[model samples]
Target: MKKNLNFLMGAVLLMATVLFASCNAEDDFLVSPVDSTGAVTRSVTTDPYVIDFANVPAAYTASDKYGANLYTGGAGQITEGYKVQLGNSGTYVQFPVNYLEQEWGEEPRPWQYDYWNGGLAVSDYTDITDGTYLNQCSVYNGGIAGVDNDKFVVAYGYSDFYNDPLSTYDKCAKIYLTDATGYTVVEEGTPVEGTVKTGTFNSVYVCNTTYSQIVMRDGNSFTTGGKSLEEQEGWFKVEFIGFASSDTSVAPTGKVTYYLANFDKSKEEESGLHGEIRTGWNQVDLTDLGTGVHMVVVNFVGSDKSDYGLNTPAYCALDNLSISL
Candidate 1:
C-alpha cells in the first residue's frame, strides 16, 4: 500500500494546518465518520497514520539484518506511530514490512490475513470517538501461535494507519488479515486455469524458480535463507471477483476501482496490462462494500504464474489506507 504520491502530499499537510470541530461520541459509535466539524476527507496523501511498508530497511543487501521478519513482517522497522498486535494476547507486536528489493522502487508484501471487517482512515482511532467499528480477530496468517484462529476460514482483509487494538489501548490500533487459500497462497502445487507460463514479466524475467542468465543483472538474487523466493519483486495485484467476502456462494454486488497509477488506465486496458498491477503503488478502492462485511470469497486473479503454478509473488507493501468511521 506504500504509494509515492508526492504530487498530493501537500494537500494533507495543508489540511492538517487548520483546526476542526469534534463529533458526537454517544451516537452511531461504530458506523460513521466523526469529524468534529462534520466534514472529514482522507486520501493516500492525507491520513492520521499511513502504514507504508517503510519498516523494511531501504538497504536489503546480503546482510543478516535483512532477515527482519521473513514471514509476515512484524513491527520491527515499520514507520513510527503505529503498534501491530497479533491475535488476542496483545503482546509481541510487529510492523508488517517485508524486505523487498527490486529494479524499480521496493516496498511490497502480499495480503495474508484470515478475516476482515473493513479498512479505516479515521481522524483519531485512538479514542474511538465517532463510531469506529473494527473486526477484533487474530490479524495474521498460519493462524495465531497457541490460540485457535483457524475458525474464520472465509478470509476478510483490512489496511490502515491506526493501531487501536480492540482492547483498552489508547492509540487507534489497526489489524489486517487475508485468507491464505483464496486471497494470497495457491500453495506449492495448485491447478491453475491457463498454462502458467505466459511470455510475461513473471514467467520470463522475475520468478525465482525460472532460471535466467540475467539473474544478477536484473538485481534478483537473495542468498540469505537460500530461498528462491527471497528475490520476488514488483507490485502484484488481486481482483476480488464478485462479493468482497470470500464466500464463493455470494455474488459480488459491487466493483473494485483503483485510485493510484502513473499513466492513463485506458492505455493499459485492452491489453495484458489491463487490471494487472504495475511497478508502482495503486490505491484499491473498496468503498462500495461499506462495513457490513464478514467473510470475503473472491474469484481470485494474479499477475504472476509459471507453467508449474503461481510464480509472481502475491505480496506488496501497504500505506495511507483510509477508512471512514
Candidate 2:
C-alpha cells in the first residue's frame, strides 16, 4: 500500500509540470508582437521613427492669428527642412500641399475661398467648446493624451474638390517618404547612407477636430436636419490607403479603416463595435500594409451625405505616426 501511494504522488507531480510548461508557452505567444490587422507577423527590432512635431519652428507658434500653421502657398520655412530624426536614422514624411496659384493679385484670392480647399496644416488650437465653430483647427482632445504633445497635423479631404468635374485634383491629404536631401541636409559627422527613408507603416494616433466632434455630438444648423449624429444613427471614418514604392499606379497594396464616430446600430451589431463618438486620441494600426510602403493617402468619409458629398466636417488630427524603418 505504501508503494502504491508513492507512485500516485509521482504521477500527480508529472502532470503538474506538464501543465505549467503548457501555460508558459501560451503566455509567451500571446505576448509576442503581432501586426495590427493580424495579417502580418513582425518583431520589434529597432525603435520606430516617431513624428511628434516637437521641432516645429517658433514662427508656427505665434499667437497673432490662430494656433495652426496653414503652410500657405504649399511651401515655406516649415516645409523647407521638415523631417524626423532619431538616433542615427532620419527621413522625410512630406505632407501634400495644395499648389497656390500666383496671379499677382491683391491678397491672392482668399485661401480656400476661390482656390485650394484641402491639404495638411500644422495646428495647436485647443478650444473644445461646442459653440466655437470658428475654431475649426482645434482638436477636441487638445493633443495626444491631452498633454504629452500639443502640435499635430490636420488632414482635410475636400469632398467638393474631389467631386467637382472641372477640378483635376483630390484634396485628400497624403504622406510620402523621401530622402533627407531637398528638406533637411545631414549635419557633419552624420552618416548619410544610414538613413532609412522608407519602411512599412506601423500605426498612427488620430483624434477628431473640435469642429467635427462638436458637429457630430450636437446637431448644428448646417447638417443632419438639426439631429445629433447619435439621433441620426450616423457614422464617420478615416481611411489610409497604402501604396507600394514600385507600382503606385496599380491598385493600393492595402487599406486600413478607422471609425471616428459610429452610432449606426446595424453596424454596431454586425461588427461588435460599441457605438460612440471619439474624443481622445486612438491608435490605428497599419502593420498589415507590409514593407516598402512609400505613400499613404488619407481619406475621410461618413454616412451623412448631401448632393455635394460628405456633410460631416472633412477634418481629422494626426500625430505620433510610427514606421518601422
Best by TM-score: 2
lDDT, candidate 2, 134-244, per-residue tens: 566677884332225667777776544336444322456667665444222244322112222567789988888888898888878767697778888889888887876
Clashes of each: 45, 0
Tell me the lDDT of model 2 at 17.
100
Candidate 2 residue spans exceeding 4 A from truth: 1-46, 60-81, 100-116, 130-133, 142-147, 158-169, 181-197, 245-248, 269-272
Whole-model Cα lDDT of every candidate shown, in order: 0.24, 0.61
Q: In model 2, what lDDT does residue 76 have?
A: 29
TM values, all candidates: 0.29, 0.67
Per-residue CA lDDT of model 1 for 106-199, tens digit only, reads 4452333211212211111011111111211111222221112111111112121222223211111222222111122234222111111100
Off by over 4 Å in 1: 1-236, 240-249, 253-267, 270-279, 295-304
**True-vs-predicted CA distance for residue 191, candidate 1, Å:** 22
lDDT of 2 at 126: 74
